[model samples]
Target: MLRFILGLVLVVGLWSAAPVAQAQNADIEATISAQLEAFKVDDFDQAFTYASPTIQGLFRTPENFGNMVRGGYPMVWRPSEVTYLELKETAGFLFQRVMITDAEGAVHLLEYQMVQMDGTWKINGVRLLANPPATA
Candidate 1:
């Protein structure tokens, strides 16, 4: 009965934590989506707001960040369609996988490194997935 009680408590604790995890996932997704929308309109100032401090410091200005996106990540800059995939944690970092269809209908899989700063989700970095799964 002692074992049973401890098991029950563990199960209940995990079950109750589900909603909090889901809410966090939603917030992370929203942050990415909002940045994409800002990019669509060439609003680099607004898009830069979603970036983590490290990223902001690296770029040093919204225009520099915008230029990098326009040249290095054109798909993200002008995605024809956007889909959110799994959010996974690896090496103590949270990565959000995104499937973006470029204006020409080409699909690209990208992983976004996300971090919470000032109680808000911010994008630390992004990289194209080198080996994405086969999609039908």
Candidate 2:
């Protein structure tokens, strides 16, 4: 009876947590989508607002952050298409995978590290991942 109760508790706990996780995922995706829209119009100031305090402190200003994106992440800066792939939590951090198709038709996978600050989701960092080799 004790084992059955414990299993029941575990199942209930997981079921209750699903909605919260789903909400978090939706918020994270919205934040990224807003930032990408800003990037599309070269509105760095607006895009910077989605970044976490740590990233803002490191970049120092919107222009600097925009410059970095333009130079180092041109695909993100000017993506022809963007698609959200997955959101996963590891080591207490949430990472969002996004697939971007550049103007030249090359696809790039990027991981955006996200954090919650004052109940709002902010982008903490972004890393470009290497593409898997063709299986042909």
Worst 10 residues of 2 by lDDT: 127-136
Q: What C-alpha lDDT, on a 0 to 100 scale, does residue 91 get in candidate 1? A: 98
Q: For candidate 1, report its TM-score.
A: 0.91
lDDT of each: 0.96, 0.94
Model 1 is weakest, by summed lDDT over 10 consecutive residues, at: 127-136
Off by over 4 Å in 1: 131-136
lDDT of 1: 0.96
lDDT of 1 at 31: 100
Candidate 2 residues lying further than 4 Å off, grouped into runs, are 1-4, 133-136
Error of 2 at 30 (Å): 0.8
RMSD of each: 1.5, 1.7
Clashes of 2: 0
